[model samples]
Target: MNTKKEKPLHSLFAGATAGAIEAFVTYPTEFVKTRSQFEGKRESPIAIIKDTLKTKGVKGLYSGCTALMAGNSLKAGVRFVSYDHFKGMLADSQGKVSTPRSLLAGLGAGMMEAIFAVTPSETIKTKLIDDAKRPNPQYRGLIHGSVQIVKQEGLKGIYRGLFPVMMRQGANSAVRFTTYVTLKQAIQTRMRTGQNMPTSVTFGIGAVAGLVTVYTTMPLDVIKTRMQSLTARQQYRNSFHCTYRIFTEEGILRFWTGTTPRLVRLMLSGGIVFTVYENIIAVIGARSPDK
Candidate 1:
C-alpha cells in the first residue's frame, strides 16, 4: 500500500488532467458506444463509425464532446479527492486500508462524483448527442444547449437519471478501485517492487480493472443512458420502468448493446487515468517541500 499522504488539491489536479486527456483521446469510441445504445437493433462499432463519418464527417464522432470532457475532468477530480478523503478516514493506524474499506471509500467517491458532476454532465452530453442525430439538430453548441435545457426543463432536466447514475458510479468505483488496488499490490509483492512498480505493469492492472467494471455495471450504464436521453420523459417514467421496458421490450441482451466500444474506451481509460494520475502525484510529491 502507498503510505505517503496525498494532498486533496494535488489529487484533484492530477485526476482532472488525467480525465481530460483520456476523454479527448477516447471520445470517438464513446460517441460510437452511445450511438449504438440508441439503436433499435444492435450495431457494430465499425458500422456506427462508418455511418457517422459518412453522415456527419470526422467531427460527427465528437458530438457532445465538450460536455463530456468537462464533466469527465470534474468527475475524476472529485472521484480521486473524495476517494482519498474517505480512504484516509478508513485507514488503520499504520496508514493502510483493507480491501473492504478501500471499496467503501471508492463507493463514497463514486456517489459523490455522481451527485456533483457526473449526472448533470452526462445528461447534457446524452441530450446533445441525441439532438445531433435528429434531422434538424436543436442545440447550437455546448453553452447554448445547456442553457436551453435548463430554460425548458429546469434543473431536473439536466439531472435526469440521477438514481441509476449513482448506482452505476458507486458500483463502478467500488469494483474498479478494489480490483486495481488488489491486483497492483499482488503484482508489486510478487515483483518485490513495493511502490516502485513499472508504469507498464500499473497500466495493465488498471486496464484489467476496467474490464471487470464494464461487465459488472453494463446494465446500469444502459439504463443511465436511456434515462438521460432526449426522450427520457416521454419514453420512460422512471429508472425502474426503464429497466422493465428494456428487459421486456428489448431483451436482456439490450443492456449490453454498446459493450464493444465501452469495453475498448474503458480499457484505455483505466490505463491512461491511473498512469497519468500516479505520475502526476509522483511529480507533486517530489516537488513537495516536506519530501
Candidate 2:
C-alpha cells in the first residue's frame, strides 16, 4: 500500500485537467440549469433544451462554456489542492482521515475555490447564459461580455454574488467531499478484500454524493444564481436581500428552481470528476519512487 500523501501542486494540475473535461461534457445540462434558475422561473429542462436547439442550434447549449471551463479549471484545481493539503494536515498519526477532518478539509477547500474562482467565473458564465436567451443581447461572446462588464461596472461587477457564492460553494463542497469520502470508505470496508476499490465504485459514490450536495444546498444555490444574475450596477444589493425577495415574491419552492438540470449535471459530472481525480492521483503516485 502506498502511504505517501499527494502533493498539493500535483493535485492542482490533476484537478484542473479533470475540471476542464467535466465542464465541456456537462455544459449543456448546466446551461439548462442556469436558465431555470434565472429570475426564479420554473421551466422544464426538456423545454429549455428544445427551445435552445431551435433558436440557437446545438451550439446554443454551450453558450457560456468558455467562462465555465476557465473558471472550473481554477476552481477544481484549488478545491483538490486545498482539500488534499488540509486533509494531510488533519490526518491522524496513522495517516487516516476522520469524518470530521474530512468535512473540515472540504469546507476549507470549498471556501478557497468560492472566493478565488466560482464568484467571477459564475458571474460571467451566468451573464452569457442569460444573454443567449435574450431578444436583445448586449455581449457578443466571452471576451466581449467580460470586457463590457469591466468597462461598465468595473471589477466588482464580475463578483456580483460573492457572499452567496461562498455560501453555496462552501456548503456544497463540504457535503460533497465528506459524503464521497464516507461512502468510499464504507465500500472499502464492506469489500475488506485488501484490493483497490473499483473505478465503478468510485463513480457510484461520487454520483450519490452529488445528489446529496445539490438537494442540501439548493437554497443557497438559487439565491446565488439570483444575486449573480443581477445587472452590473447591482440590483439586489446583497445575498440577504436577494434571498428575502426570492422567498417573499416567489415562495419557498422558488429556491428549488433548476433542481432537475442541476441534479443531472452534478450526478454525471461529479462521478466523472472524482473518478478521474482518483485515477490520475493513483497513476502519479505509482510512477513516483517514494510511493
Candidate 3:
C-alpha cells in the first residue's frame, strides 16, 4: 500500500483546481438556477434557458463567471483544507476516520467556507446575475460591486443570507464527504485489489454524493438564493422574511425554483471536484515528507 500521508496544503490546491474546473463546465446551469431563484416562478429549466438565450445570448449564460470561478477556487480550497485538517485531528484511536467524525469534519469545512468565501462571492455573483436586464447596472464588476455593497449597505450586506448559506453548505459537506468516504470504501472492498482506486469510480461516487447533498438541502438553498438575489428595491428583508413571503405569497412549491438546474450543476460539480480532490491527495501523499 502507498504509505504517504496527506497534507493540508494539498487539500487546498486540490479543491481550488477542482472547483475552477467545475465552475467552468457547469456555469451555465448555475446561471439558470440563480435566474430561476430570482424569478420566483414555476418555469421549466428549458424555458429559463430559452429566455436567457433570447434575451442575453450565450454570454448571458456565463455572466458573473469570473467572480464565480475565483470565488469557487477559494471556496473549495478552504473547504477541503479545513475538512482534511479537522478530520485528521478527529481521527479515532486506531487512526481511522469514522463516518460520524467525517460528517462533523464536513460541517466544519462548510461553515468555514460560508464565512470566508461563499458569502462574498455569492453576493457579488448573484448581484451580477440578477442584473441581466439593467442597462446601467450599479455594480460594474466583481471588485466594484463588492465595494459598492459595502458603501451602500455595509459589511452586513455582504453576508445577507449567512445562516441559510451555512445550512446549505453544512449539509453539502456533511453529506458529500461522508457519502464519498463510504462509497470509496465500498468500491475498494468490492474491487478486492491492492492498487489505487480508479478516477472513474471516485467521480461516480462524488456525483452520487452531490445528488444526495442537493436533495437533502435544496430548501435551504432556495431560501439562501432568494435572500441573496434580491434587488436593492425588493421587499424581502432577510432569510426568515424571505421564506415567510415565499410560503405565504408564492406557495411552498416556489421554494424549489431552481431544483432542476441546481441538481445538474451540483451533480457535475460534486463529482468533478471530489474526484480531482482525491486524486490530488494521492499525488501529494506520495510526495509528502512523511512518506
lDDT string, candidate 1, 146-168, tens digits: 99999999999999999999999
Per-prediction TM-score: 0.95, 0.93, 0.91
Query: What is candidate 1's TM-score against the reference?
Result: 0.95
lDDT of 3 by residue, 86-195 (tens): 88778876678878888998999999999999888887788788776466666677787778878888888878888998988888898988887888777667774556
Clashes of 2: 0
Q: What is the full ranking by lDDT, best candidate first? A: 1, 2, 3
Clashing pairs in 1: none
The positional error of residue 110 in candidate 3, measured at the CA in angstroms, is: 0.5
- In candidate 3, position 265 carries an lDDT of 91
Pick by lDDT: which candidate is best? Answer: 1
List of clashing residue pairs for candidate 3? none
Q: In order, what lDDT does every prediction score?
A: 0.90, 0.84, 0.80
Can you write out model 2's per-residue Cα lDDT over 88-182, one digit (the tens) per residue?
88888888887877888888899999999999999999989888898778889999999998897799889888888888888888899999878
Backbone clashes, candidate 1: 0
